[model samples]
Target chain A: MICVENISKSFNGRAVLRDVSLEMQEGETLAIIGRSGSGKSVLMKHAIGLLQPDKGRVLVDGIDIGRISYRELRTVRRQFGVLFQGGALFDSMSAFDNVAFPIRTFTDSTEQQVRDRVLRCLDLVNLSDVGTKRPSELSGGMIKRVALARAVALEPRYILYDEPTSGLDPHTSTTINNLIKGLADQLDVTSGER
Target chain B: MAALEQRLIRPLYSLGRYALLLSKGFTSLGHFSVYRKNLIVQCGRVGIDSIPIVALAAAFSGAVTTVQTAYQLVSPFIPPSVIGAVVVPSLILELGAIVTGFILAGRVGARIAAELGTMRVTEQIDALEAMGLNSIGYLIVPRIMAGIIMFPVLYVTAVLVGVGGGLAAAVATDVVSTGEFIRGARENYLVFGPMFGLIKSFVFGFVITSISCYMGYYTEGGAEGVGRSTTQAAVISCVYILLSDLVLALVLL
Candidate 1:
């Protein structure tokens, strides 16, 4: 569970989020609907401790995240999977390596295990054939799908999608939406926050 | 009043942020293998790739110095050997060092700033942070390490090439006999001459690379911002090089 209490955030003294409050419980498929520049992403970013609110507290489970040490914050962050509006995939890395990055960072998984998991995640996202491609080589839709494959590579407890369906054609968007739903059911994800 | 405060306080804020980033780069080393790989890559970028430009600039500058020194200082009263003595020390202590510093301040500094600024604007840095990675340890430290390690080496190479050019110029112009020039070069050579150049360049490398990294790492806006940061990195690095040159000269000379 995550709780945002009276959160307020501003940039250059201009408030973006004002007195916002919300709670998200486990196993919930939450959708944040707002027009562009309506602070939807900003609010979602604060919920995961990515962007701290200037006033008010974010409680991940029961712990006030801002008060904790960086080590603790990082540990808390491991539970989250975020697909930024832009693919935010490492342009320098191949698709396979990007998906394998989190596993390499956090787990003592063997090379074979890492490869198997990466391939499986790519298969899940239907980007299995383009594992060797760099982000630049992939189309915009391909990049987003590859980024989504990377986000779920770790089997994160909560997945945050920022505009996952924003730029895709109807077919591609539907495909992505179905994958999001299928992955939640198959992985038994505790929370699918969009 | 606001503009005045901003002018004064902005630097302080930037200084605080720079120091914070430096501290993170020093302390939060994520993995040794990752750091080693990044360091090697950055070393190639800063050192191996910069040789041609540094050599070319220093060579011409050294040649001009030799010609000018011979023209001005040559008389029956002063020995031709004095040209060698003056040129060698000048190249080792200031000419070669400052020339190499300037090259790196523009080239490596802009490259670092542009690369990092692009990463920041493209959300790569944020992605690293979101993935529970120490972005500073991953990005800034390797570039900083490369700068500190390579600057002195490039300086040495620059000084040697420059002095060689000076010697060639002297020989061509009949400014000084080969024997007289060599004798004077050996005669006035102090242990501190090369040391001063090496030390100054070593610090210069850090200043150029780190300032550029800081500027890029915190960059905002977008493509235009990357362009602005790149220009700022080159300009600021050059200014800092001149300032450091003055301080090093006052202390060492």
Candidate 2:
């Protein structure tokens, strides 16, 4: 479970999050709905240990994320996956390499194992045939799915989606929403919490 | 009275921030290899691409040094051999260090600042941070490592090019025989002097890389910000390299 306790973040003396507190249990799909500049991204960043609160703490599975060292933070980060709004794919790498990045960086998997795992993740996102394409060549929905595949490449216990359906058509958005629902259900079955 | 306090306190706060940044940069060295591939790319861009200009500058500097020394040696009390001695020491101590540093400021320093400043503006650095990676380790450490390794190698190349230019000037003017000039150069080849040049190059590399990275990292705005950062990196690296060279010469010489 991830718990945020009275988290307050300010920039240049202006408060963005004012004593915000929340808890996310295992296997739960909690959609953060807010208008523009509603601090939705900041809240997500804080929850995932990407940003620190000025006046509170964020605990990921009983570990205080903000105060831990970077080395320890990596371990915590390994349990969570983030699909950025912009995809954030390394432009220099192919889709296959992009999906395999986290596995290569954090795991001791052999090259063949990494390749097989990346292919499996790509298959889950229904992008099995686009592994050789760059992010620039993909359509909006395709890029998002590739990014999602990269995010879940490590088989993370938790996943954070930032405007995953923001730029797509309604039909594509529904497809993405269905994928999110399915993944959340899988998490529930595996973790027995959420 | 309150305004005076604010003025003094603001600079103190800036200084504190600079100190904190330096400490963070030093601590980040252990994770330098994370960006090794990027560093290799950057080194090729900065060092190898700029070799033609560096060689041109070194050649002209060598010719000018030869001319000046030859003119000054016309005194009855001064032997012509003293010209090589004077040029050798000056080249190793001042010309070698300062010229190479200036070249790097124009080439490598500006490139680093502009590239990183673009990355900063484009939110790439923020993306790396959001992934729980240390930005310093992911970006600056590799550049620093590359600068330190490559600067000395470039300085040696500069020395060879400069000497070849001096030989060319000598042949053109017939001021000294080729054999005589070569003999004089061989006699004045002090190992310690070139060692000083090597040390200066290393120090200059640190200055260039640190100042460029700092300017790039703190850049704001957009294209204009990147341009300003590049200019600042080049200017600050050149100034710091010259100042550090003087200090090292005083201590080592």
Candidate 3:
């Protein structure tokens, strides 16, 4: 569960978010609809521990994110998987490695285990055959799917999506929406989507 | 008064931020194998890829130094061996380190800045952070390690090829016989010359790479911002190298 209380943010004295408040219970889906530059991304960043709000506190599972120890913050970070506005894939790595990165970084899994899990995630996102390609080689939509695959690679407890459908076609977008719904049902995870 | 405050305070703020960045970059480091793997790759890129150009520049400097020295010392009172004497000390004590430092400030520094700046604009750095990784440690440390390790090696190469170029020029111009050149090189030679050169190059390596990485890590905007950062990295690295060169010479020599 995540709770955002009276969040306010400003940049150089102009307000972006003013006293916004929200909550998400376990396994719930919260969709935030706002116009462009409406602090949607900033609010999302705060939720995922990426940014801090100027005048409020964000509590993830009842613990204040701002007050956590570094080790605890890292542990909290592992619970999240985020799909950035752009794909944000590592340009140097192949699609397979990008999806496999979390598994490799946090897990002591074997090579076969890593490979199997990476392939499974890729298959889930309909990108099984594109694992060998680098991010530069993939089309924009393919890049988004690869990023989505990477987001869910660790089977994280909470997933966040920011404009995940912008660069994708309607068919692909529907497919992704379906994937998100299915994954939520299967994994029993909470999600925040914009 | 407002403009003065803006100009003055901004740099002070930036300086504080830069120092904080350097400190953050050096701490809470983990993931050894990843760092080691990245270090090896950076070593090849920063060191090996830079040799040909460094050698070429050194050779030109050496050849010209020899020719000019030979031309000026045409009097009977001056021995031909003095050409080697002048060239060897010049290459080791100053020329090799200075030339290699300047070249790499343009080559390696600009490349690092541009690469990191691109990563910044593309949100790759944020992505790395999102994945529970220390992006600075993962990206900057290995490059810094690679730079300090490789610069001295490149400088030594420059000195060797530079001396060879001088020897070759001597043979071509009939300025000094091989035996005379060797004798002159052996005259008044102290281990301190190479020692000083190595020390200067070492510090140069540390400054050029770290400064470049710092500039790139903080880069904003888009492609045009990347170009600006690249130019800034090159120019700043060169300035730091030249300044440090003077400091190193005064302290060491």
Candidate 4:
């Protein structure tokens, strides 16, 4: 479970989030809908400990995020899968390797096991053919799907999506929405979307 | 008072930030297994890719030094072999490493800054952190490792090519025969000369890579910020290289 309690944040002394509170429980899909610049992403970042709140605190699985050391925070973060607004794919790597990155970094799986898992992830995202392509070669929607494949490679317990469907066409948007919903249902994981 | 603060306080603040980044990079070490492939890739990028330009700069510097030395020592009593003696020591002790450093300050340093700055702007670094990876250890360590390992390799290349270029120039100019030039260099050769040069190259490599990584890692804004960081990395690396060169010369020589 992720708990954000009365968190306030300011940038350059200008208030962005003021006394915000939210809770995402196990196997729940909670979407924070707001207009642009409404601090939805900021609140999400605080929940993940990517940004520290000016006031109040965030708790992940009962451990205070702000109080924990970076090492501990990393341990907590491993349980999360975050898809950024821009996909944030490593441009140098092909889509397959990008998805395989976390798996290789954190696991001691053999080459065959890694290849199988990467293919399965790509298949989940409907990007099986584009695995060999670099991010620059992939379209916006494709990049997001590849990034989603990467995010979910570790089977994270909590998945966060920041503008996941933004910049996508209507058909692609529906596909992404269905994919997120399906994944949440299939994985039985809590999801927070901004 | 504002100007004074900008001059003194701002630099101190920047220095503090640099030191902090370096400390964090060192402390949050990643597993060797994770970074091994990257280290090899970075070694190829930083060392092997730079050979052509380093060789070109080193060759010209050596050839010019040989010709100039021969021209300056025009005394009838002084043999032409003096040109080789002067050229060899100059190339070994100072010119080879310094020239290679300045070249890499622009080449490797700016490239690292630009690449990392792009990653920063594009949120790749943040993505790495969000993935529970130490972004510093993953990204910066291999580049710095490559720099320290490769810069000395480039230095050796520079000295060898520089000496060969000097010999070629000497033969072409008829300033000294090949035999006399080799004899002159052999007579003046001290083991400390190459040692000092290697030490200088190693330090230059660290300065260039670390400063570039720092500038790139903390980059802000967007495209403009990346451009600014790349320029700053090159400029700062060059400045540090020259400063360290002076210090090394004073202390070692």
Stretches of model 1 off by over 4 angstroms after superposition? A191-194
lDDT of 1 by residue, A73-123 (tens): 878888888888888999879999999988988898999999999999999
Give Cα distance to truth, residue B120, candidate 2, Å.
3.2
lDDT of 1 at A98: 94
TM-score of 4: 0.97
Number of the candidate with higher TM-score, 1 or 4 = 4
Candidate 3: stretches off by over 4 Å: A69-71
| lDDT, candidate 2, B192-243, per-residue tens | 8888999998999888987898889878999999999999999988888878
Highest TM-score, which number? 4
Q: Candidate 3 residues A112-186, lDDT tens each? A: 999999999999888899989999999888888899899999998898889888867899889888888887998
TM-score per model over all chains: 0.95, 0.85, 0.96, 0.97
DockQ, Cα level, model 2:
0.32
lDDT of 3 by residue, B1-253 (tens): 9899999999898789877776766775776875788899999999999999999999999999999999998569999999998998999999999999999999999999999999998888888877777788889989998999999999999999999999999999998998898799999577899999999988999999999998899898899999999999999999989899888878777
Tens digits of per-residue lDDT for model 1 on B79-154? 9999889888889989888899889988999999999999998888877777777888889999999999999888
Candidate 2: true interface contacts recovered: 0.22
Q: Which is the winner by TM-score between candidate 2 and candidate 3?
A: 3
Off by over 4 Å in 4: B1-7
Q: Would you list the rank order by lDDT, best first?
A: 4, 3, 1, 2
The per-candidate TM-score of the B chain, in the order shown, comes to: 0.97, 0.89, 0.97, 0.97
